[model samples]
Target: MSGPRTIWRSIATGLGALALLVCAASANTASAQAPPPDIGFDQNLGAQLPLDLKFQDENGETVELKSYFGKKPVVLMPVYYKCPMLCGLELNGLVRCLRGLNMSIGMTAEKDFEILTYSIDHREKPALATQKRRQYLAAYDCPAANDGWHFLTGDEESIKKLNEVIGFRTQYDEITGQYAHAAGLVVCTPDGMLSRYLYGVEFEPKDLRLAVVESSEGKVGGLSEHILLYCFRYDPASGKYGLAIMNFLRAGGVLTLLILGTAITMMLRKERGMMESHRLLEGSTHG
Candidate 1:
């Protein structure tokens, strides 16, 4: 009887240890799958940005957020100038996309749109912003970048307000002394209304061009661009402009009808002219 009791006790202890291990494993897996608490973006589409926020530009001159708005759509980027990895990748990717844009989109910045990048880390100063502007402008090789592209730094209050308005959430890691932030660009309307968000380090030039045109309320693009806009709509889930199949089909059908109508009208006019000429020739011969 004693030996049987001892075996049962041992079995109970082993089962308890296994249960604990399983629970720990499940918890670890969940933790790994969950996004870091500090970093993410909330798509606050149509939210009005606080244009009164002030920041020091790359030139160390204080400027109002409204100054960059009201003329052209603004491309807002939230990044720390000293970031070691993601920020640099995002900036480089943007330059590449900008270089790839078609002539209709216009390569000049302020003329077409504005690029406003402010540091998430308030500790960073205008000096770093100036340095980064130079480095990226050299890579961009665009003369207008000096005027169109801007880098800024501000106090924590202003930075936090801007971040909240744009739904750009960030977390600072004490151990690494680095910020963890989601990479994306916010396209705002000329009136400072949030219009679109393009995510990821790499972006398609077409997407950027469409975003600019869409944000500008059709003010910055050509006829072809307007047609493209009619055919494509922005998908927030994918963060890209996807073809609206129905709209494309409808546009195609309309264009086909227009072409057919024009052809038929021209054929009828030609037949009438030929008949009139035949009558004239017959009358001349009779006379």
Candidate 2:
């Protein structure tokens, strides 16, 4: 597995692939809009989002951050609508994974989640956002997603604040006239709390399901679904999911506690039944 420190600039020739180009920016040549050297994600778990911040949705209606909450876990994705290569590939990877899942975006089931794609580039307009949403939805073939999925555009100030809260760092490249940002999804809870972040463009359905379920605090799925969480964990270094050694060690203790609780409940119930029977017999003798 490669380290997350891997950084470079590339141009997407088409939807199929991205051509990596090693272009270094000189200090004098750097654009004022260019981001710092740290163009990546720093996951802040359980971070409370600024629900008061505002944005324009795809329909050109202004809404607060709170509008998207209180229903289901949200998958927050920050992208530029006009991004030539990287953003499209990221969206393509996401749509492919979503298409594979049995759970639809807008419907409630054992597994349900919301998606928020915010344009980090403040220059993007609602019209561009709507167009991008139309393109992705039409390509995805999931009409239900039109309701659950959201594409938002905000001012530079709002975008900056939201980026600080999520620690999503991105920089613009003066040479390429594109923004250099990391690719990942932040899984947030219903109350607008950051829960987990899964990196990279390609995502596994199992990982996505687990992330949604875990972010909801097991509110959406059953106990059986949690078995995977006990074994697997998100590895930031590799930007992938792998075995959880600590959880594996604690599972035995948790199972033992559950078994002990059940046995204690049964014993108390038996004793109570016996006492009731004795009282009835004594009353009958007195009569």
Q: Which ten residues in a row have the lowest lDDT in candidate 1?
A: 101-110
lDDT of each model, Cα atoms only?
0.91, 0.82
Per-residue alpha-carbon lDDT of candidate 1 for residues 1-287, written as tens digits (9 for 90 to 100): 99999999999999999999999999999888957567788889999999999999998999999999998999999999989999999999998888787244564687789999999998999999999999998988878556889999999999999999989999898889999899999999999999999999998888988999999998898898888899999999878999999999998999999999999999999999999999999999999
Q: Tens digit of lDDT per residue, candidate 2, span 1-287?
A: 24433322222233224222222344345664645567888988879999999999998999998998887899999999888888888899888788877554333222388889999998999999999988888766766566878899999999999999998998877888799899988889999999888788887777787888888887877666688877888775655678888887798778899999999999999999999999999999999
Runs of candidate 2 with Cα error greater than 4 angstroms are 1-36, 103-111, 245-287
List pairs with backbone clashes in candidate 1.
none
- The superposed Cα distance between candidate 2 and the true structure at residue 170, in angstroms, equals 1.4
Tell me the lDDT of model 2 at 257: 92
TM-scores vs. true structure, each candidate: 0.84, 0.70
* Top-lDDT candidate index: 1
**Maximum-TM-score candidate:** 1
